[model samples]
Target: MALDALGSPAAARDGMLDVTRDGRPSARIHVTSRGGEGRALVLVHGAGVDGSFFGGLASAFAGRRVVTYDRRGCGVSSDALDGDWSLDAQAADLAAIIRKAGAPADVVAHSLGSLVAMRALELAPGLMRRLVLIEPPLFVGLDPADPVFQNLVRAGQALAKGHTSTLFMLALERENMGDAIRPFTQDELAFRERDVQTHADHEAGWMLAYKPDLARIRAQGVPVLLCMSERSASTYHARNQDFLARGMGADLMRLPGGHNAPRDYPDEVATRLSTWL
Candidate 1:
């Protein structure tokens, strides 16, 4: 099933691509491709979201081959984790996807997805021509004593202790989006529930523990466009993006709307992406 411009199901080209790592079967990823020309641009979604999250954004790139896929267990991708689900594993999955979609692709990754793309770039150099990272949550450089960071850590701990994923995600949205938070439709809620069951635990645990190899990424010299939302309520993400921009020597672009700008402001995001990519 292909997703429409608003991320709803519609008729379009879709396929299931098998991803492998170290000569072993890794995942059977559900991929959707659209548009006409230019370098293949892949959209990598963040935690608790799937390829459908980029449906609207994907439609905006009219002339570029835009590929969006459900990352491993998210959406319709294979859910058999086989007890090995970490950021590194996700990065490998991404590398395989990039190779299948067309190597030297341009990537636009959001939130935790940015981390996965960065890791993939480090692991598979020259696979990506350009990268656009949107608000990666890197708490490594932040002061642990800060109240905002403390709250975020506590929320993760709650999830680790079996706190309700719905409530956890609601709290997260409130924190990040503040008054801009909107009600999720029934389908959106269902997707969120499935994603939470599949990835929330790992996201709260090992994913948070994973750190990027900034030095290796810098050495590769892949052009990066770091994006942050103008109305994001969280200081954690803003500070982290600033740190990342400086560390990677990336060109930073500020877009309107909250952290989920692709959903809320697809036109603006696409315009900026077209200019950058």
Candidate 2:
């Protein structure tokens, strides 16, 4: 497999697949695959970004097939939102991708993507063999009065009050990711900017209201690894990861860098993933 100048898988290996829900054509997901042998390792991205968000990290899984796809309404995937932004629908999309990649694949999901992956595992047990959840914003587990939670609510409210999605997304990245976004290239930043509306309009509220089915996930008996960035360990994201690690009986990994560690410090994240998986 070839890598681009940025160390991401080149566009020559890109593919497209249609995701169906209830036997109806739902989304046209853009997928990128590379590497060979071993079980497929699927990369699921979070909000405000697309599958390319994992470009830096996906190429590091030596000998294992790595797959990454743009979620509906984000990246090069279907732009039609309709009712597809719901958590169930997003999970269904993930399930379809896992099935296409061959069942029993391992998954590495970041932020909101982690929630979708967990829900997918619950909805269709045994589709994924191992799970790595990276700093998922499981807000339900956090204190309602916490400053971060309160600020998130305010951000949403501001969006409802007529803030531009781009501005909202910029604020969000600054707040949650801080200087982590600085290491990303200009093209990467533009890619995320384009999908701000999809997140600000359709996904943010749903993410805030989502309640993880921890019992079902725990019952699945799938081995899970919870990853938290060193910088984020002092924020609400770390709290959420800590809560999930305990609830799901998952092994905790402390990686270098901030929330966007996979992008800023891909080799380090990949090294840990290789060891964990």
lDDT of each: 0.75, 0.77
Taking the tens digit of each residue's C-alpha lDDT, what string does model 2 give over 1-277? 1212112333326666776777777777777778675577889998888887787787666666788888888887786434566888888888877777778999999988988998898889989889999888777777777776776677667666767553355336534473464366664576686677788777777776778788789889999999988888556677677678778889989888888888778888999988988
Which segments of candidate 1 are over 4 A away from where they belong?
1-11, 164-174, 178-190
Model 2's alpha-carbon lDDT is 0.77
Return the TM-score for candidate 1, rounded to 2 decimals. Answer: 0.87
| 262: Cα error in model 2, Å | 0.3
Give me candidate 2's TM-score against the actual structure.
0.87
| Pairs that collide, model 2 | none
- CA shift of 249, model 2, Å: 1.4
| Cα lDDT tens digits for candidate 1, 100-125 | 66688899999878888988988889
Taking all chains together, each candidate's TM-score versus the true structure is 0.87, 0.87
Worst-scoring 10-residue span by lDDT in model 1? 2-11
- Residue 226 lDDT in candidate 1: 88
For candidate 1, give the lDDT of residue 37. Answer: 57
